[model samples]
Target: MTAGVDTGGRAPGRPRSAHVDEAIIEAVLGLLAEGGSVETLSIEAIAARAGVGKATIYRRWSGKEALLVDAIASLKGPPPEPLGESVREDLIRLLSVGPKKPDERTAQIMSCLVPEVQRSPERYRLYQGLVEPRREVMRQVLRQGISSGELRADLDVEVAVAALTAPVLIQRMLRWHPGLDDESLPARVVDTLLAGLAH
Candidate 1:
């Protein structure tokens, strides 16, 4: 699990409440689902929605952008921990977990947020920072496969990572294609890539 955000200036020994954190995060997502943008979301509005004080939110996050990043990350949770038993199983497992079929609200929020993030470089960087750790998880899995002689030694890990992830992302985030809800998708993707990657 991702560690709790550092409470930079909080008094020593004052533990943050998980309940409050969750409420605040939920409030941000709720606002976004209601068509709130990063620019328009205010600390006061979040605090009011979450039923907490502005000071409570400020103690946890420097600003709304930082808070928004964390809120989005919470939706995905952490990257799956690879089993390390085999590349195919691990890759499939990694891909299989998380929201397979986004709810209507989630889909609506992503539709708006995706373009907004792309248009703002700062937001794009924050989004990249949020996703890179998950990509690193995949990279590590592919590297292990190569080391164990399960994958071709010369396989381009970066390319393979993109190839393996892009379809699911497109379907889930953009809904540009059908069949993201297919339970067998992870295995199918792994198998298709393995045909060329396997040693």
Candidate 2:
């Protein structure tokens, strides 16, 4: 081979950057915070808020629904797999994994989602993909409690999850009352639920 000869001649592949991913996601949240509805949140607006080109977003996401799903999903870090050891401990860890107390700004962002979905229900079914994983995490912890004899074996997983989380959601997402977004709320919810289910 000649010295300085071209090596593999093809241009290096430029994989997408995480920073760009984060910016786009943040832009979605920002637009939601600013009262932008789902139907109105264009790729152009998101690209502008994120300070990236429209092509960059389209390369990563096919449309606004996908982008919204991803952005909402990014609001929190991934939940830890629920270890069977001490359900209380596991619950605490899971609750603490993400943003603990979503404040008014956070609540405002979430509050806008319902009306947005109502605007174009079919286009936003993608949102369901983001919710199932979180539900599964809670269910895992509940199943562990059942197997460990810490909770009633007959407990309904779906109902239990809704009960366990409803208080926080109601206070923070549904209504904006002061002092409702307490960091200790989940720990308290777990305790109250377990107390009722203890055999």
Candidate 3:
């Protein structure tokens, strides 16, 4: 739910470039894509990749774990308010969320992070901080639809939400199906499910 993080709290020094923050995050993600294991990744690697001094990174983050958290969290944008009163309209909006730019790096970061997050509590905590709130909103929207009789009275909101999200995650993120990653995909998925679930 929180977006637009506080920009203050930097180490006492000359002001840092807003671009430096981005470059450090880009470095972390880039290293992650190259399979930067704990044994291999270090402050030196990130600083070198980001084209900055170690102090520049340290100025913003206390250490690697803190830096990684900030990097992953930045990939997730602020959750948008549900756009429509109807369940179908809202589902379409929620499911189409992604970067405005055409880049594979964001997906690549997620592809790498999904499994790694499980073993690292630090990573899991940081990943969940961005994911859990958005899921809760989807659940709320489904429940409201059910109560209003827009959806099946017997519809399980939990199952519905999973049904709503799983295809996009699986095909887009897990399986890497090229055909399924189009802009129309969200609408198509929602329509298919709503036809069966809507009363």
Candidate 4:
């Protein structure tokens, strides 16, 4: 496949191929899913699975954690926008709908990353890179709902965002639940959160 080079136009070298990058990420994800800590993830295992040299992997990532973080960051896409006019509809839409499907790789990485996040505080930067941009989008919609009188004006949108996502994450990662589907999750989350936000 293609190789992954930094494409922010920072350097002049061979353009990284998307195919190679995908393969490397897929390989790293599979290893993490198999269950291992950051220290356990080795360049040899990754190179073997990805069919690339260790030097090549190092060229892209400084270490296993960096590589793993980058791999997780690649799996996510933008979240959906609010469609209906009211807060209830907006909450439901934001919670339940998205433009892309969540896959096993994402689920696995998230499962592993939770523990990593707890052990290392500095990793929030990586987590933010992977998940926060999408959160920002939802925050804007929540602000709009408040402005339109669809939601209570004083509700803390930041806390509200955590309330929306933290439960699903806990259920999936800790309680061993099958995890909520997008369709039903929104309605439940909206009902619960709106109850608290309502005057």
Candidate 5:
């Protein structure tokens, strides 16, 4: 029941059903959860899993890559909308809103996709398309901090964003630490970066 894929524009046929869309996406995730990769995934299998025809999926997406991209994007939902009230608070909010629980299925899906995306340039670009907009949200917050003189005037926004976000993402995606559920971790990360970046 995450967001559905954007069909871009209307096609000259029956309108797309949100129910069918969710079924297709869930089918993709279900397969990935069972250890399927992009290489191993096929439209035929997805159609069967979703209880739809191959033409149904084709009507929604061009191929497996496009369908997979939309499915993964749905998993992420949407990025947090940053409040303009305070830079530190906004950054913390963005960093804190991710899978805090031990979701083996999500972790497994990521593990399956990360390497495969890295190896394929097309997949890498599609993945970047999904990630960069979220990163840009953080960049905009950093720029606002600079404008308000809340952060160092010479602060490199990209580096500041990376420093602030990397640790949290590493923990959430890779589970490198024992504190995935640590609610205070976001504030600590923001404060630590601010100590160096704050004006």
Candidate 6:
């Protein structure tokens, strides 16, 4: 029998063996969440968990860094839609929804990357490519609020964007908290931030 043979047989939309590609991604994510840093993440481990061969993973990624970069890039969700309300409300909505357990693997990788971001310009650029678009989405929403007169025209949208996200990030990165208390965190952030921006 083939190494990846489907003894149970294949179905429509399913690969002959398991879908090696998806398994690879899942395996990588699991490792990352399990406190495996980029340096610590091994291709062998990924292949083992994925139930795919080493060559299969290698055929897709040039190296561990490249594989990690792709995996991390895929993990992000698109920027959220703006809620129909005041800037404070919208911000609350934005920050309220986030990873419940958070990805420990990604966290470990990022912790390592943060300090080296300056030293590795290309790596930092890759990070920005994945993360910046999300920030821009927030910026656009804030700008729209300003134009619609929902928020003060004098508001520094960029600064406000940071203010909206900073606490959430700090809590996750520093304390390793799971998801935020949606009922309170978002509302509190909105209230405090709007106090500075509301005209």
Q: Which prediction has the highest TM-score against the true structure?
A: 1
- In candidate 1, residue 196 scores what lDDT? 60
Candidate 2's residue-wise lDDT over 21-84, tens digit each? 7888888889888888877889999999899999888777767766776666666556467766
Worst 10 residues of 5 by lDDT: 1-10
- Candidate rank order under lDDT: 5, 1, 3, 2, 4, 6
Q: How many backbone clashes does candidate 5 have?
A: 0
Writing each residue's lDDT as its tens digit, candidate 1 over 7-114 gives: 345666778788898899999889998998867889999999999999888888877877877777776767689989899999998887666555667776777788
State the displacement of the C-alpha of residue 87, model 5, in Å, after optimal TM-score superposition: 0.5
Each prediction's RMSD to truth: 2.6, 8.0, 3.4, 4.1, 2.9, 7.1
* Per-model tally of clashing residue pairs: 0, 0, 0, 3, 0, 2
Q: What is the model-wide C-alpha lDDT for candidate 5?
A: 0.82
Give the TM-score of each candidate.
Answer: 0.89, 0.82, 0.80, 0.75, 0.88, 0.72
Better of 1 and 2 by lDDT: 1
Worst 10 residues of 1 by lDDT: 1-10
lDDT (0-100) at residue 56 of candidate 1?
Answer: 88
Per-residue CA lDDT of candidate 4, range 30-127, in tens? Answer: 88887766667888999999999987776666667677766665554344666757767776666654324555555666778777877776776667
The lDDT per prediction is 0.81, 0.72, 0.74, 0.68, 0.82, 0.66
Candidate 2: 10-residue stretch with minimal lDDT: 1-10
C-alpha lDDT (0 to 100) for residue 110 of candidate 1: 71
For residue 188, model 3's alpha carbon misses the true position, in angstroms, by 1.5
Model 6 quality (TM-score): 0.72
List the lowest-lDDT window of 10 residues for candidate 6: 1-10
After superposition, the stretches of candidate 4 with alpha carbons farther than 4 Å from their true spots are 1-11, 79-90, 97-108, 175-183, 195-199
